[model samples]
Target: MTDYKLGRDYARQQDQNDPLKTYRNQFHIPKDEDGEDAVYMTGNSLGLQPKITATYVNEELESWAKLGVEGHVEGKHPWLHYHEFLTDTMADIVGAKPSEVVVMNTLTANLHFMMVSFYQPTKERYKILIESDAFPSDKYAVESQLRHHGFDDQEGLILWQPREGEELLRYEDLEAILEDQGEHIALVLIGGVNYYTGQFFNLKRITDLGHKYGCMVGFDCAHGAGNVPLNLHQSGADFAVWCTYKYLNSGPGSLAGCFVHERHGNSPELNRFTGWWSHNKKTRFNMRGAFDMLPGAEGWQLSNPPILSMAAIRASLDVFKDVGFEILVQKSKKLTGYFEFLLKDLGEDVIRIITPENPEERGCQLSIQVKNADKTLHDKLTKSGVISDWREPDVIRCAPTPLYNTFEDVYELVERLKKILNG
Candidate 1:
């Protein structure tokens, strides 16, 4: 067991020495009525905006006002290829080659676009597998795809469920489903990180299992994108989609990122819904020929994207570029470990952490399950200036983001939780 005082003191000391600690000042930390910074642990929902975001957006707006239509080419950020500027930095963060990644539509939209190419279902092999508790949007997208293919969703869909009374899904269970239904399953679509339970699934292992069963595998990484290290290239999945609004800190409802494995990059035969943007860049504006798709993920784009949203992503990515994911993840492990350490000390009888205990199995978000206490406890914590998320029934999610959250932030949050629980 770690010494409580030592842990508390060490947390404070770590904040003092932290290289990324100064980044907290770069964001506008929310405050309570008393003028104190609210713990701000909801980065998992909507990340705090970087101060430079407005500046980045305003520059584009200024160019629009001054140059009018010429802003498409003459703006400080050329609107024509604005999305291209973000590709390299985003590819680095998601662990994909530049050609494999593209910034495009919102999360659900990208998922649909990916499905157009990857979720090809045939007569015998037509079933799609997904987590039983997948986010509502994903469930809807898959169901719609099934309907579009002339198959009843209930018949064409397969759900990999957790064991009775369990909050997290097991790989063994997933394997069992694949073994029993492997013959009929055509695709495996999974959430890279469970939004509610904060469980980080092993992507490579899942991909391997699905491939063994002759299934196409894809991932919806809304919660996992910036939260966990998703080596999409190494994971060998056919495709993946994720949003930037959460851990990527690209503001609310930002453009999403999609990855298409290099193996399929040049496969012109692969089917996808296309538009002018997906045509060859050299002759894109020629506007007089058949649709020749661009190679890799860029080929998936259906239309020109919103430049304002891309600007927010650019600003946030610049910060990530400066610090690097390696350093951010290192601090994340420690900060979240401390949060877990302190929560465990509160005793499991009163408050149970639903998230996995292993650091490698999760990012920084911790889902706390409070016994006998309902949302009231969450309300109390909020009143005390701790800004955490509350799910229905009884779960409070607190994400100690490494870019801004300090060790002291974790310590203080736990202390507040303990006081609320004891009272």
Candidate 2:
């Protein structure tokens, strides 16, 4: 544990020593009324824009203006194989092999597509399992999947809820559920990092248990992708999906990523929704040829790459590449740990941090519950120049992204909140 102090000078001193300190300048931090940079702590919801994003986006615009139709084959970065450019870096970020990863579609879209292939449900093993507090979108998607398969959504859905009165999930509880209904469950889809509590689950442990009982396992890594080091391939999950707009610093509603374990890459028997993009590149343009599926995650692609969105993703990825992911994760632990340290000083009677105390079990986000406070508290913080996410009723989610947030930012956020709580 870090020996955290209670003053602003300490925070600035830590920032001065931070190797990643200069990166804060690379992003365009939101401005306050005085035109000063706001203490932007909502990277988990939407990351700040990188200053260079426009340059990359405009390159694609120039290509379209100059080369027109020929841009697909003749541009600086050809649109024909544009998605391929993101493969290696994204694979490295998520700890998967290049062949097993691809950037495509939106988060829920990828999840549904992955389910089409992995959620092979028999009449007996037709149920799907997810956390009780899963992101509403994930819950809705899974419920719809059950309904689409002609099963009663309510009966087919199994929730691995936390024990009564507890906020974080216990592994033993998950084990117990799997032991009881493993055979009946065809799919175990979990958020790699639970959005509500910022709890990072043990993916490998869950995957192993699910596989033990003949269940296909997958993860919605929307909150984990750039915020934490998710070793997706090592987790032995059948499939995984994540969005790029949050910790990835990509533009809003940008394309997402998908991972298929290398083991299933060549499984031609697996059912999937396919398009010409999934066909063999050589034969893709040869209209007369029969459908030939490309092996690996690329085979999941349903349409040609969207270059403009991809360019923004590429730009953000370049920033990640410049600062290696390992280094980013190292900085994340320190920043969040420091944030936790300061919040704890605010007194447990007044402040409660529901996120795991262990740095390994979370990313940079800390979900805070101000005792006896409501949404008005969140609104006050916003007015005080602290841009954060407010979960209904009481929780305030603050993520001090390692890429651009400083120790001072974390310090100021807590101090501002402390001031509000005091009054």
In terms of TM-score, the best-performing candidate is 2
Name the 10 consecutive residues with the lowest summed lDDT in model 2: 1-10
Task: For model 2, name the residue pairs that clash.
Answer: none
Instruction: Tell me which residue pairs clash in candidate 1.
Output: none
lDDT of 2 at 311: 97
Candidate 1 Cα outliers beyond 4 Å, as residue runs: 1-8
Report the lDDT tens digits of candidate 2 across residue range 208-320: 98999999999999999998989999999999999999999898999999999999998899999999999999989988988999999999999987899999999999998
lDDT of 1: 0.90
RMSD of each: 1.4, 0.7
